[model samples]
Target: MDWLLKATTPAEKILVMFVAILLFAGVMAFILYVSEKLPRWIPAVGFLLPAVIMLAFGLLWPGLRTIFDSFRDAAGRKSVGVDNYVTVLTNPDFQIILLNTLAWVVAVPLLSTVFGLLYAVLVDRTRFEKLAKTLIFLPMAISMVGASIIWKFVYQYKPATANQTGFANQILVWLGLPPQQFLLNPPWNTGFLIVIMIWIQTGFAMTILSASIKAIPDEITEAAQIDGAGSLSTFFNITVPSIRPALIVVITTIAMATLKIFDIVRTATGGQFQTSVIANEFYSQKFSQGNNGIAATLAVILFVLVIPIVIYNVRQMRISEGER
Candidate 1:
């Protein structure tokens, strides 16, 4: 056990992992072997016991510990009660972070879903539908860090007179305008970061919403056409109503993702230029500033924020399922 805990070399770490896997497998094998002779109810408990123990140790313990640490001081040695939470809510800097997070949550999902729905509608049965979707969905296949790095270069700034390397700045130079620092300016800089998220998420939104649109009954659409409904009227009156549940799912799902955004801000700006969200701020507080209490508080706040969105999403899903 000590050897496993203190594994230093790659070989030793691999050996330790292998040993742990073998031990887990052997234990499960024993449990299965013994369960054959056990009562029917006992077998179910036997199967679930390992999973419950793992979840308790891995998730429940860490979650409770984080909540506990939220009340401790910066050094995590003294009780500070709600001081960290107070500072987070009251401090001007944290206020900006909260606002930025709010902007991200609002902007990303709304814009992404709108763009996705529009694109999905435009290419629903087009000759180049596959190619068009592939172009947009290609970004979704890239890792968030990769997408951020790509956009970071695209937004890269240079002196007005100097040769511009960034595609956006180059275009600006072509228009005889001064090169703007997209990542350096506050407020608007946050919008630029939000674009990266929207770019990635739009693909996800389009795929889900497109499937929902296709699932709409042809008879309903044909009946609308048989009446006085034009293309625009049919879309608004028929398509939109039919896909409302999917729209809710997409918006809430993207909102949750936006709330937890860290990689884009971290990679593009290092959360500098007043662009930090709660996820990045918590990471900076915990590791960079060594303020565990505030970090834990932010973590708790993030967890709390996600719960309502998740609940709403689940409820919407259940309603959709019941309707089906």
Candidate 2:
């Protein structure tokens, strides 16, 4: 057991992994062999059993526990009914979080999609088009945490007297203006953080939308042009309507990602300066503050928020498929 806990050598760890894999293979083989000898339904049961058990243990049971914990006290020793939910809904800090999250969900997807669509259109088929699209889409390759760090330096503020290390403040100094604290200011700080999300997610929006735009038949554009439709008119009248489904999917996906934006907020702001959103607040309550009840309540709120978007996305997908 001690050796199992700590394999000191690389060879020992490799040997342990090999043995585990061999055991797993043997168990799987034995199950299949036994199931073949049993009734036809037995193999079907065997095939489904692992997945069912995994769903139960991993998703269903934890979800139920979280929901159950939402109604319980912080220590889980007593029931508190709706107190947790009420507190989260009415508390000023949590209210601010909800508002910030709402702003993020509204602003990021819309702005990102708009920028992405514009960029996609700009470089549609011009010379160096691939290079241009690649540059715009490169941000999506960076992790959220990495993007935040990159933008954090970009937004870094310094005292006017000090030599400015931050790009933003350096530009201010060069322009004979005062350096401003970007992340330290509340409300506006949240907006600055939201910009980071938009920058990263814009590439995702562009990639999807560019594909959708390319799929739009060139004949339609040519006919529109023949009808004296300007480029702007063609985009609004034909290209947009043709790609509406992809636009909806992009917006919904980004909204979901924006709602669950934790890494950037946590890594950049540490949920301070009134920049905390629901996901970050959930982490704060659960791990930092040890307010388990409030954490569970926040989790439930996030879950509720996501359900409608997911349902709408699925419905839209089905509608598109039906239309096709």
Q: Please state every model's RMSD to the true fold in angstroms.
A: 2.1, 2.2
Top candidate (lDDT): 1
* Tens digits of lDDT, candidate 1, 158-191: 8987799899999989898899999999989999
**Model 2 misplaced stretches (Cα beyond 4 Å):** 6-41
**Each model's lDDT:** 0.95, 0.92
Best by TM-score: 1
Candidate 1's clash total is 0
Would you list the clashing residue pairs of candidate 2?
none
lDDT of 2 by residue, 1-324 (tens): 665668889988988888889988997898788888887676888877878999999999999999999999888779999999999889887799999999999999999999999988887889998888888889888888899999999988777888899898898889999998999998899999999998988889999999999999889999999999998999999999999999999999999999999999999999999999999999999898898988998999999999999999999999999999
